[model samples]
Target chain A: MNLLLLHPDQRLDGDRWRLDDRQATHVRSVLKLAEGDHCRAGLLDEGTGQAVIESIKNNEIEISFKVDSKPVFALPLNLLLALPRPKMLKRLLVDAASLGIKNIVLVNAAKVDKSYWQTPNLKGDLLREKLLLGLEQAGDPVMPRLRLAPRFRPFVEDELDQWAGPGRRLVAHPGPFPELPRGLDEPATLAIGPEGGWTPFEVALLEQQGFGCHRFGSRILRVETALPALVGALMRLP
Target chain B: MNLLLLHPDQRLDGDRWRLDDRQATHVRSVLKLAEGDHCRAGLLDEGTGQAVIESIKNNEIEISFKVDSKPVFALPLNLLLALPRPKMLKRLLVDAASLGIKNIVLVNAAKVDKSYWQTPNLKGDLLREKLLLGLEQAGDPVMPRLRLAPRFRPFVEDELDQWAGPGRRLVAHPGPFPELPRGLDEPATLAIGPEGGWTPFEVALLEQQGFGCHRFGSRILRVETALPALVGALMRLP
Candidate 1:
């Protein structure tokens, strides 16, 4: 808990702010912070700054800080991923935010079970909780933007055009399609499939949109394992 | 466990094998193997084959295998990594084996603590334990070959030259080095640094010997996170 993230409702006046029950408990209990001890705080979508503890009691705490500096860092690129299981999704949210991903689009893959979307972790508050963990780990005060699209075809065809970055688009597939171009310093929109992977029709649709089918290796990797790998590779290019 | 990996001592006859106290417990308790149950078994240096449970009783169990095929899906590249923390190292060992890496060259890194080498996981038996877990996950019978070189300089300049393959060589560094080449479809040798990463001196030495420095992104990554990312990126390349 490097940064104590506060929801918008927590703000009080000018430099003063109030923390919710959860964060107040964490600061008072886990951090053992006392009056005069400074702690970091951020408002969702607003900005970040240091907050000096004004008082702490029960499940409430008061803080003061200069709220000018931005509180977080979102990744330069947007990630559109197929929703994985709850446990894995929790880790993904944290890791993605820690890496400063700006936007995440969790779309439905054909193999995605309906039960996965109903996981408690997907709840707005819980999702924010996991993202905050990542933000704190990365020492960023900002939160990554997240969007859920339960339907795949509509999201890809209707919304994908607006999401593609300035450079080439690549889709990671099992078998080889083309070699990842070298010295690719420009921003790119890369797509990774689900555990069972994208079907032939899905791959064909993506290909028609100029998304090249590419593979990382012959070995199969779980989604949690694949996301960072793809990001690292893309980031490595020029 | 997908594949049960055994040591040389476990092999009794052409097809018969004996389970030690620990393995016997895993077979009986975890897997709940009974007479005539089918399993996969692989020798440390030999091939993988199907095993049949002959009997299960007391503290020991008897099993037999049909010797036919060799377990042969080792990664296309060799991984030269600095020793990470004991816990992460344990995971790395299992992941390396499961990912089908044949040789793991553990060297002392400038940032690596001297105490890490003394971890029980580095011990022969302990290391084998993790590799067995990896083999099981991969459904492969063969275990990976593990090697340790106390010094980084001597090993790379001397022993490593012999195993260097004919392709791009990369070192994970967080510097101004050009983005790593994308779409690597050929054989290569990749080197990873310790927690704090390689020193300037080490980087210069490595670069002098044909290794190019590659940075994943601006944010620093833990060693455990870096491995799969680098491996995935390289493998994704054509």
Candidate 2:
């Protein structure tokens, strides 16, 4: 953990902040911070703040905090990804959140097996578990909104317009195309397909809705691999 | 495996090629290739070629090939990374290869434990295994050359200059200014520190040698997260 993240609710009386087992153990063992040593911490789902080490005993580490700063607003990129397998999904969720993605929409694709949708990772508690890890990695408090839309067609046809941040909408496809827009001047919503990639019809449906189709390169990238490359390309734009 | 990769030496007489157990099982089971069926195959450490299923009944499936095109080269960037733990090292090796990185210099960092350098993943045979997997993922034949330089200073001061491609050099460090060159048009050799990031002294050495210090924003990213991001950014430059 780069930074110790705390939530507003974790604050007890006055300056004292309560930490859970995982955070406590990390502070105690991994970081090995002694009392009076200063470490950075942020309010979970709130703001970035500094935390002073007050005491360490048992599995709990009590921290004292000062005023909270305004939380960082993420880049207005809405990543629509076909959820990868469980392990990769966990890392992607955390990485996306840490990278300041404002929102993520996990959808089912033709290449996605039905079983992946049923994994325990989709559960609210489980999803939050991963997102929190992401938040901690980012040193941000506010969690990016997460949505699971199992039905691909309705979500894209109906809900997409409402969710897109305004500007370009691109889908990552491998065959051939003009280069994807780099350093997009405005906010964008990028759609990444599953590991096996979207079926031809799925790509066609997205394209019909004004989503430009572009390939990163001739090389095919995994869903997670495509995320940073596409997001970085957009970051370079404008 | 999207494509079966074979070394140039692996090519045999007429329509027959020797098959390893791993490749044999993958062909017979996963791909389910039967007699007379066609599948994509390429020459390892060389070029891409086509393979036809000549027979499939025995313990090994014999295949025939038509020598066609050479494999694509990697992006201009050469990855110089601080050795991570075994699992992440495996992923990094594979991903770098799949993305067609020609050379990877795994060096020590202050934050990287000595044990990580001793990981079996760093061993020759194991490293080859990961690179082959990466080659298969890209449908490319050439495996990236892995170089080990235990000490950071000598490697950076001596060998790095020789191995540096004809382009810019940048180190991914979190700090003010020294933003990554926008629209990098040159072939660059980039270095990334371990998860904890490079030390101030290390960053200074790189800067003294005209290596630009670049930051991918404020959030600290996993080593894996940063690789493709850097690749995408470098690809967009100039």
For this target, which candidate reaches the highest lDDT against the unseen true structure? 2
Instruction: Specify the CAPRI tier of model 1.
Output: acceptable
Local accuracy of candidate 1 as per-residue lDDT tens digits, B120-155: 778888888887777766666666678888888898
lDDT for each residue of candidate 2 in B123-215, tens digit (9 for 90 to 100): 799988988888798787877888888898998887777788578888877777556664454578888898888888888777766688877
Second chain TM-score per prediction? Answer: 0.88, 0.93
Give the TM-score comparing model 2 with the true structure, all chains together: 0.94
> Fnat of the models, one by one?
0.36, 0.41
DockQ, 0 to 1 scale, candidate 2: 0.49
Tens digit of per-residue lDDT, candidate 1, span A20-63? 77778888787898989987766666776778999876777888
- What's the TM-score of candidate 2 when only chain A is evaluated? 0.93
Candidate 2, residue B34: the lDDT equals 81
Measured against the true chain A, the candidates' chain A TM-scores are 0.86, 0.93
List residue ranges in candidate 2 displaced over 4 A: A236-238, B182-185, B236-238
